[model samples]
Target: MSWRIHHVSLPTRDVRETAEFYTEVLGMAESSPPWKDQDRGEFDIDLAHVAWFQGENAQVHLSRHSRNFARDNNFHLDPIINGHVAIEVDDLDAVRERLRRKGVYFADPGNWALSGLDQIYVLDPALNAVEINSQLK
Candidate 1:
C-alpha cells in the first residue's frame, strides 16, 4: 500500500503569526491561500499553505485552538510542550544566516548529526519549535 502524509497540525495561539513564521522565516513556499470551511460551523478554520520538498511529503496546518472545542472536548496540549516541526532546506547555512540576520535565534548553532547535514533549531513567534536541516531524504 502506498501512503502519503497529507497534512500535519500545528496548534497555535495565533494563526496569522504562526503561518507567517513558516512562510517568511523558514522560506517555505505558500502552497495555497488560507482555507475556510463553513461546513464546520462550530469554529472558524483558517488553514494556511504547506511546503513539501524533495522526498519529504508533509505539510504544516496551523490550527487555531478554538475555545468551543476546548470547552467541549477538554483536550489540549500545554503550549510549552517540547513539540517541533522540521523542514529541510537546500542551503542550510545561508538560510540560517538569513534568519539570524532577521533576529531569529537558533537553539542549536552549527551542531549537525551524522547525516552530513547542518541543522538550526528555532522557535516561532507562537513558541512552536521549528527545525531547519539540510537533510531531506
Candidate 2:
C-alpha cells in the first residue's frame, strides 16, 4: 500500500479569516465544497465549522477550536494543534492490516460528515495524530 502526505490540519477560532489569510497571504486557494456536511447520524461530532486551502503540494484543513474535539494523543495532539497530518492511502485494508501486525492502534476509518471521505486516526510514537484516508474503492 502506498501512502502519501495528503494535508495538514489546523484549528482556528475564525475559519473564514484563517481561510482568507491562507488564500491572500500564503497563496493557498480555497478548495471546492469548503463546508463539512453529514446526515444526522453518520458520525458523532459537533458539526464544526471548517474550511480547506490548497497549496502546491498539500491541502490545509482549518477547523474551529473546541474543547470537545480534544484527544489525549492529539499532536499536541488533540484539536489543539494547528491540526493533524493527513495521509492518503491506496489500500486502506492492507494498511490497516499492516498496522495491526505492527501492533499500531488506530480509531475510525470513518467517513466525514460532509465529504463522505473515509479516514482513520492514528498516533505516532510522540503522540502526534496522523489521519489516514481511504481511496473509497
Q: Highest TM-score, which number?
A: 2
Q: On residues 36-77, what C-alpha lDDT tens digit does candidate 2 reach at each position?
A: 353444433333467766777678778786665545223233
lDDT (Cα, tens digit) per residue for candidate 1, span 1-137? 12233334566666667767876898776554223333445333335322222224765655554445423533232221343566666667677678879987665534332134455667678887666666433
lDDT of each: 0.52, 0.67
RMSD, model 2, all Cα superposed? 4.5
Which pairs of residues clash in candidate 1, taking residues 3 or more apart in a chain or in different chains?
none
User: Which parts of model 1 are misplaced by more than 4 Å?
Assistant: 1-80, 109-114
* Worst-scoring 10-residue span by lDDT in model 2: 71-80
**Candidate 2 collision pairs:** 9-83, 10-82, 11-82, 37-113, 37-114, 74-77, 74-78
| Candidate 2 overall lDDT versus native | 0.67
Q: In terms of lDDT, which candidate is strongest?
A: 2
Off by over 4 Å in 2: 32-48, 55-57, 70-82, 114-116
The C-alpha TM-scores of every prediction are 0.38, 0.71
